[model samples]
Target: MRVVFLGLAVPNMNEYHNMFTELVVEFRNNGHDIMVVAPTYDEKVFGMQVEDGIPTLRVPTLELFGVGKIQKGLATLLLPYQYKRALKKSKIDLNFDLVMMPTPPITLVNVASWLKRKYGSKMYLILRDIFPQNALDLGMMNPKGLAYTYFRKKEKEMYFASDYIGCMSPGNIDYVIRHNPEQNANKLHLLPNWAWLQPNLGQQEIIKIKDQYGLLDKFIVVFGGNIGKPQKMENIVALAKSCTTNKDIFFLIIGGGNEKEYLDRMILREDLSNVRVKDFLSREEFFKVLQIADVGLISLSENFTIPNIPSKSLVYFNARVPILASVDLNTDFGTHLEAIGAGLWAEAGKTKKLKEKLMYLYNNPEKRKKMGENGYQYFKNNLLASMAYENIISRVTNT
Candidate 1:
């Protein structure tokens, strides 16, 4: 099979590990020809390159990440045009068996539609982020405004263009069905986030990480990933404030985003010494910290109407660390955790309830250990990268 993946970023496969790269690697390993088309901020870096045996075409685009919302919006709106022009200039083959993309910039619908028309390709959408609605939910956009109306149309178009829509959770599937009644239910399938599993870090390596970070004999509760608006990081700050009296319980936040300054301000204002914040770490570094963590924290804004299953949880599950989530009521994340006997959760913005759950994990060592074991078992049984590869391959081939 020849597959072309369109995504926001394609890292150097040898130096980075992410869900997309891992999945593409699986495809490459299984004897599929894969081409990744992604954006690069540096013009000099824009071109085709084979990284770790996968051919990737880096298209030049405006700065997207860590920029103002207006700039980010413009860049997203230009993605389809940029990608199309780049593909033409490169003179690469357009005959793809599968055209795959994960949502963020739903504007890619145009590119996908063009490819499908040109080559009769099957479009697969890895529905990670639901747009426009998520914007409205976060109060980032007015539903009555032009931007919302435009993106809402694009969202539908993207869905229409897709031959199959792979939802992250049952709640996501339900949301899509209820919202887009025109979409065929048969085309929607559950394709959870997946990762290339890594072996657990040894106790000596864990101790070295703990010592290097000045974290010794403390129950580390970690939140690692993008510390942005969707995260509702204030909730994590509130939790940290609540736990300040307990010296043994420490909050370690590792990530960078627009909200990091806000989080830092809150921590300083509250005079909370138990909480520490670190900037984003490499994939290898993150798992080392995760391995030493007692609980992996997940936070979502209470405002979100969409059911977002954070990809961050997969890292926690893979690390054999139990999750303690404060998420919106709409998501099935908490329910999923409970079903797997992997963690506990509370409704977002409920500091008291979140604290109680955290305390429960802190007080019960045996339960925590069991939950960690269960999470690892669940990861092996359900969330392997090979499972996702087979799921998509079987559907695309049979159809």
Candidate 2:
């Protein structure tokens, strides 16, 4: 089958690794013809290339970084039109069997509708990030405002146009249905965020990695991902502040985003010797860090009602690192971690509880190793790329 996968996330082959990449690779391996339509702000004209044996079309869209809220919103609002123009200009055969897309700029209903109409393609919505409502929950946008109304309409249309809606979790599914009661019940499916890390580090290699990262003798608590507003990263700073007296415990915070500078400022201002910040590493380097670390951290803003299962935690799971999740009470993310004995959880922004959990894990070496093993085992059994690929195939074929 020919599959067209669309997303804003254009993966760098040498550096980037995510669930999307994993699924596409598996699709290619399974003998499906894959076409990736990803966004690029660097190109004025649409660029076409073959990446890692898969044909890719880079659609030109407005740059989203270092911009104010209004500018960012305008750019996102224009993406669908830009994407449509690119696809039409490419003049590729309109014969895709399945067209899968994830949400962020949730204005893809127009493109998806066009694809379905032109090619009789089955549209699959990988509902990773729910919009409008998420913005409303965070007070970023007013529900009664025109912008919210506009996005909400697009969100509903995207759902209505979708042949299948793959939700991140049970909570996500419930939220969608509850909010949009008009949506078809049969169209929804639980498509978990997958983890496909294959680590083969020996004891010596692990020690070498720790030494390389300056975590040789410290109890490394690693937070490896986007340090964006949604992360509620101030709580992480609070955690570091609370643990300042514990010389053995170290915070290795990696990744960059809008809120990253705030963390840097806080670390500097407070003279928090226990905390360290670094830019994003290549996937391989990140795995090495994860493998060497004693604990992994996952966080979400308390403002979010959307059940975002941060896919980053799955990377930690694959590395056999015990998790320390600070997420909203509404989300199932922290709960899932605790249930599987993969990690401990605290409410989002609750520094006191986060400190307590961290101290417990730090003091208990046996528990740390045991929880890490449990997470790894659970990941192997239930959350792999192959499993996700199979689920996608089943949905596409059996529908």
Candidate 3:
């Protein structure tokens, strides 16, 4: 079988996980031909398509919005057309059996819908993030306006266009069916956001990496992902400030975001030595360090319940590191962590509680290590990327 995986996510590989490569590997291993169509804002991304020996063809890029809502909106409004142009650019001399699309820019569904209609492909919606509803929930977009209505309508179309759909979690299922009740529930599958960090690197090996990086002396609490507004990181920053006296504790933030510069400035103004900021590292470097890091710092804005699950926590598990998740309690994310003993505080994401939780892990290595052990077991049972491969094969093959 030939698979046409459509999404703009691959070339910007730093922004995505190893799921593309993992699936690519599994498909090729099973003797299926894989073709990926990834769009970009630049010519090409290096180091893509290196895994699985699967070939990829990149499409067109989007224009950068210097900085404004209107300019960004215009860029988004034009994306369905851009996706169509990219679709036309793909050199698929051979036909495809399945159309796999990811989201964030939900308009990718239009391309999938087009492929299914014109070429008779089976469309599979691999939902990574849910959409303008996420933005609106986070207070980024007005919920009661024409803009909201337009996005809500498009969101429904994306949901409806998929012949079968897979999501990162049941929380996502709740969101989808709540909005698009007409979609067949049996067609929906919980395709968990997968963790790809192979764990043969044991505690001794990971400890050596930490020692080499001079990170062994500190109780490292690492937050490694997009440092943006939805992070609601002012509270996180304030907690970092509060931990200034705890010289043995360190805060490592690794990722770029719209608000990263502001986060950097806050660190500078506050003269935070315990807190260090680094641009996102390569997967190997990032996970190697995480494997030794004492704790994972997972967070979501209290209001952002729909579109995000912040797949980063899976890394902490794969690395056998405990987590400190700061999401709303009502959400499944918090509940999942609580159920698995991955470590979370009941108090709201207040500065006091944040600092308190950090200190708890910092002072109690034994307890932290136990939480990490629990996480490793949880990852083995649930979040491995290979599980996703089997699930996809089963769904596409209808086995």
Candidate 4:
């Protein structure tokens, strides 16, 4: 099978740790020819490159990350055209059996439709982010405005264009079906986020990394990945403020995003000495930190009406760390955690309940150990790249 993957951003083939990259590697390992088509704002990095035995076409695109909503919206609106133009100019063959893409820039619908028409390709949507609705959830977009209407239309087009829609969870499948009655129910299927599982870091290496970061002798509650609007970072700040008197409990925030300044300001304004914020770390560095950390923290905004199963949870699962989540009511992530005995969760704005769950994990070392072990076992059994690969291949081939 020859597959072409289109995404907003894709790392070089050498960096194959993320969900999409891992999935791509699985296809290649199974003797399928795969190519990546992604956008790059850096002119120096634009054009095609064969990285570590994979052909990747980096089409020049406007800056999308770390920009204001207006600018970001414009960039997203232009992405499909940019992709189409680049693919037309490139010498790489467009005759692919499958065309795969992840949502975010839903405008990619046009390009996917074009490819399907031109080459008779099967279009598969890896639904990671549900846009327009998510923006409305965060109060970032006016529901009645033109921008919302435009993206909502694009979202529908993307869904209708897809041959199969892979949702992150059961709640997502339900939401999509209930809201978008035009979509075929049989087309929606579960495709949870996955990672390439790696072995845990040795104790000495973990200790060295902890000491280097001045995180030694602390009950570290680490929140990694994007610190964006959907994260509801204030809840984490409130928790840190409440735990200020407890010298043993420390908060470590890793990753950068639009709301990073807000988090920094709140920490300083509240005189929080127990919290530390660090920029994004490499995969290797983050894994070491996860290994040494006592708990993994997940925070989602209370305003969300759509269920979001954060991909970061896979990192915690792979690292064998217990999770303490404060998420929106719509998300079934909390239920999944409790079912597997891998973590605890409370509604996003319920500070008291969140504190209780956090403290329960903090006070019970044996329980934490058991939960971490359970999570790692579950990841091995259900959430590996190979499992996701088989799921996708079997569906595509059978169809």
| Ordering by lDDT | 1, 4, 2, 3
- Any residue pairs clashing in model 4, and if so which? none
Writing each residue's lDDT as its tens digit, candidate 1 over 37-88 gives 9998776777898888888988889999899989999999999999999888
Per-residue alpha-carbon lDDT of candidate 4 for residues 88-141, written as tens digits (9 for 90 to 100): 889778999999999877888899899999999999999988888999999998
> Each model's TM-score?
0.98, 0.96, 0.88, 0.98
Cα-based lDDT for every prediction: 0.91, 0.86, 0.74, 0.90
Please say which candidate is ahead in lDDT: 2 or 3: 2
lDDT of 3 by residue, 1-399 (tens): 878776554634324446665666666677887777665566655223433355665545555333566766776677767756655654345357887877767767777788778889888888877778778877778888888888888888887788778887788888778777887777788888886657458668877987886887887888898787777777667778998888887888888878889999998999988888989898778887777678888777777657466778777788788888777644577677778887875433676877777788887889888998898898899777778878887887873
Measured over all alpha carbons after superposition, the RMSD of each candidate to the real structure, in angstroms, is: 1.0, 1.6, 3.2, 1.1
User: Which of 2 and 4 is the better model by lDDT?
Assistant: 4
Q: Please give the RMSD of candidate 4 to the true structure.
A: 1.1
- RMSD of candidate 2 to the true fold? 1.6
Off by over 4 Å in 3: 12-17, 44-52, 63-72, 89-91, 200-214, 346-348
Q: Which ten residues in a row have the lowest lDDT in candidate 2?
A: 9-18
lDDT over C-alpha atoms for residue 14 of model 1 = 60
Q: Show where candidate 2 strays beyond 4 Å.
A: 14-16
Question: In model 4, how large is the Cα lDDT of residue 357?
Answer: 93
Which 10 consecutive positions of candidate 1 have the poorest summed lDDT?
A: 9-18
